[model samples]
Target: MRRSVELEIITEALSKMGPHTPATRLWGRAPDATADMAAEGNVWAGDVHDVALHIVTRLYGRPGTPREASPLAQAEDAKRRRDMGDEIAALTGAHDQLTSAPWYPARPGDLVHVHYEQAGDLPPFGETYIVGHVGAGLMSLQLLAHTLPETVPGLDAEATAAMAGCFAAEAADCPVYEAWFEAGPRSLTIVRDGRPVHIGGAP
Candidate 1:
């Protein structure tokens, strides 16, 4: 029989009996079992139901069955979990706040990066796009380079110009629609996204 089931049965029997249950452990290899306390560990004690339960739990219970964690250990684990949650929330808020501002006052045909403030299966690095029409405090952006970005590492201008050249012989405007337009769920923060490439009158 499984140790857990046997223990349950033994416990049920002990429950029905008096507190001073005549509990004894015949500790040995089965057939030559003997009522002894010298084999290993405190297998049994005086006539008590608690002692019987402890003996059965130690001897017949599943090996390496983890006992419930102590209160202090549990508290520490909860604190660590709470701390981790706070850290993740802080990181997300920081990212959203950073992306909430436009790098510059963008104009039509300017190269830009469109940021994604929400989580999903998206490009980890921001996508490169070209700013399009602006009307009624809302600006549109066209998908320029998705697979191969127009910008280079360390914001290298010459290398990026070469890469952009490789993408196209000349720059041209593309149409934008609501389907392609990027915005949050609640309200449109068009000015916050679509940051322009030019800085100090240079690309």
Candidate 2:
């Protein structure tokens, strides 16, 4: 059976479950079993129902399975829905805000100063980072050279880069900075010497 045909069958069957069915739940079933079947080149055979059942078993487990026995299962469904709701809200609100903001086409040597709060338990402090690789939606940055404090000691470039990446992802949730990305040019506010600066005269 061709892959396209198999997909068509799966789509038709799943469509019967209604349009609002979560795609993740539909695809989350029996991933390993599907892969094994595919390795044998027989995934699109007459076992589509079996493969789908495998997926449902993985997601919801066997019928009559005791949920009260496990502490972790107590609030799993509620938590999953809540987390999914939060994710959808962020993607719709913050993501939309970012993609629609003013943008400038980033260059190879462009400098970006990212203002982010430090992680973990410590006095709240902001640090500056230098941008490295820049894309329309994402930018990689690292700590500025010669900016490390003597007290920190042994913080190498690799560690700094890793930390910067974490901070950048976290900073996306920050309301103070109206930074987001879309298809064309990258959008972010660049600050220098305690003042806002524009690149290529972008407002």
Find the candidate with the highest lDDT and give its number: 1
Residue-level lDDT of model 2, residues 1-203, one tens digit each, is: 11232244554576456365433333332444654454544433334455555543333232233221111232244367776643444344434433443543333333454333333432223334454444444555444432323333356656644443333332122222332322111123455444555431132
Per-residue C-alpha lDDT of model 1 across residues 125-156, encoded as one tens digit per residue? 43455565655555556556544345545656
Candidate 1 runs further than 4 Å off: 1-107, 113-127, 148-203
- In model 1, which range of ten residues has the least summed lDDT? 179-188
lDDT at position 126, candidate 2: 32
**Listing every candidate in turn, what is its Cα RMSD in Å to the true structure after a full C-alpha superposition?**
24.6, 17.1
TM-score of each: 0.22, 0.31
In terms of lDDT, model 1 sits at 0.39
RMSD of 1: 24.6
